[model samples]
Target: MKILVVDDEPLARERLARMVERLDGHELVAQAANAEAALQLIEERDPDVVLLDIRMPGTDGLVAAEQIAERPNPPAVIFCTAFDEHALDAFGTSAVGYLLKPVKTEQLTQVLDKARRTNKLQRAELTDSAPAAGNGQRTYLSAKTHRGVDLIPIDNIRCLIADQKYVTVYHTEGEHLLDETLKDLEQEFAQQLVRIHRNALVAIAHIQGLERNAMGQCRVRLEGIDTAPVVSRRHTQSIRSLIQQL
Candidate 1:
């Protein structure tokens, strides 16, 4: 597989290059110091996979991934970082995998294989699933939660709370912390999910209204639900604006 190495540090790029060379069917085609360079190489080389760093000088890896993904043919991204807490949530991006710093050779091989398989699956799905081009809103998601992998429908989600690295997926019956991030799923499902806070995304259809208790802290009420989800005071205006739109 053709690969692109992206990292701000020279030593880190060298380490990844060596690892790719060690793999049987892998070759490093390009290397970049920042997101801009990475984007340029991706447009020119069209690599099969990108070994991307989460943190960079100009643009963070997550934001870079979003930009690349908007292109006509985007490469599969495998985020390399020191943080493991975000591994679960990043799965929403359909990334081949997330590798922590000082990545082991064995782990690299496993993730590479996984990436290859996932890339094939994504291509197949794109061809098989007919596009709804200008019709109704789309639903369904492939998420990794504590209960393992979940093929959750958007309608089933009552609310979503963005934790440090993962988003908590709440349903009518229960709630689960998904290994997926808010940015990964929020934009696509904007009509279905409403941004109550910078870190919190809730199902718009399920929201009943906004509430204020004796404590003066604003709370969000959901239809057919008793418990009220707290909406931070800072996000009060944002919530009200969204409610008016609804």
Candidate 2:
């Protein structure tokens, strides 16, 4: 597990880093002296766990934890502080673990276990709640970025292409990974994207024209995309009829 240690005291940070390194499977990615630096490290490294100190010079750990929670994929927060009064407040922010310092090795181990379990549950929830395009009310794909969630409008999507187990959603900005399958995407955006291939779906608006190559196979060209998606036999007739109507 990747870990980021955040504490204002240099000795405390170094001590915590050493203790974390001694563990079997944990990797100490980086250490930060302040909450602001901690937030920056979190954004850059995306550590699985953050051992945060509650009291700092500026931007206290609680405030930083709240900001971390807002991230698309936030790391588990384990607030390690000398004060016991902030326990309730820490849990309220959905902190996975809390350690009262004068640190204990056994306590650290237990918190690490709890943090892993909590992180798993959070990821499961994200996967379950991930919005799909087909829902009438959900006309956007909530793509999780390095920073936060980006709500991509369906109109900006050019196509969806399946690569192995994952589906890549191509939009005006770029492509984002989708959790849904090609079938689900087609069902959701039935009014917009037409299935050109078994693994591909193209936007109806971008469907400029069709071309038949020397091999007598039909292909579709989009407005800005140069690569043509081949129309499968089953969808070819319907696509042709739809183009004629337009």
Candidate 3:
């Protein structure tokens, strides 16, 4: 499979490319330092797979995957990240597969083979159907809480409210405060998440609908739950867009 290696670190990309070269069936077609360059290379090279990094200077891997998958012919993606926890949910993005950092040769070969097989199966299934927006698959959240790392399923989350420095992820079990800033997580889970407010990120599937009261204050109702959350004025348009799409 022809592959494009993408990462900000020169050594990381080089090492990954060399690994790909070591594999018999795989070929390194290009290398990119950021998402923009990756996109440009995708348009130009049309490689079969992308070895992408999660974090970058601008337009992180997740955001770039969203845009690339929206394109006419997007190459399969395999996130080469340092975080092992992200591996479980990275497939929800446009990623066909994922590999942890300092990626072992054996693991790389295994994921590459899986990517090829999965790609074939996916194409066969979509052969008779129109191109869909996305599979509508929900991803789990790995957040570091007081006790330790907690796994919060996206379906259980009602909304994510951004505080001064942290984003409060509200779920049926209880609310958990995560350390990462809201904007970072927003980009990572853009498909399943919606920016309901500058300080809030609401799961699109959880949103039942918008209710406008006599006072002209509009609130968002959570699906399968009774509590209604306030929708900030700034995010009204995006909320409406999400509702219409759904």
Best by TM-score: 1
What local lDDT score does residue 183 receive in model 2, on the 0 to 100 scale? Answer: 95
TM-scores for all candidates: the values are 0.53, 0.51, 0.50
Which digits, one per residue and each the tens of the lDDT, describe model 3 over residues 31-103?
Answer: 9999999999988998888888988898888888777777765677778889766654565554556778998
Score residue 162 of candidate 3 by CA lDDT. Answer: 76
**Candidate 3: misplaced stretches above 4 Å?**
123-246
| Leading candidate by lDDT | 2
Q: Provide the overall lDDT of each model, using Cα atoms, as 2-decimal numbers.
A: 0.74, 0.78, 0.74
> Over all chains combined, what TM-score does candidate 1 have?
0.53
Cα displacement (Å) at residue 28, model 2: 0.1
- Residue 115 in model 3: shift from native, Å? 1.4
**Residue pairs with backbone overlap in model 3:** none
Model 2 lDDT, residue 217, Cα? 88
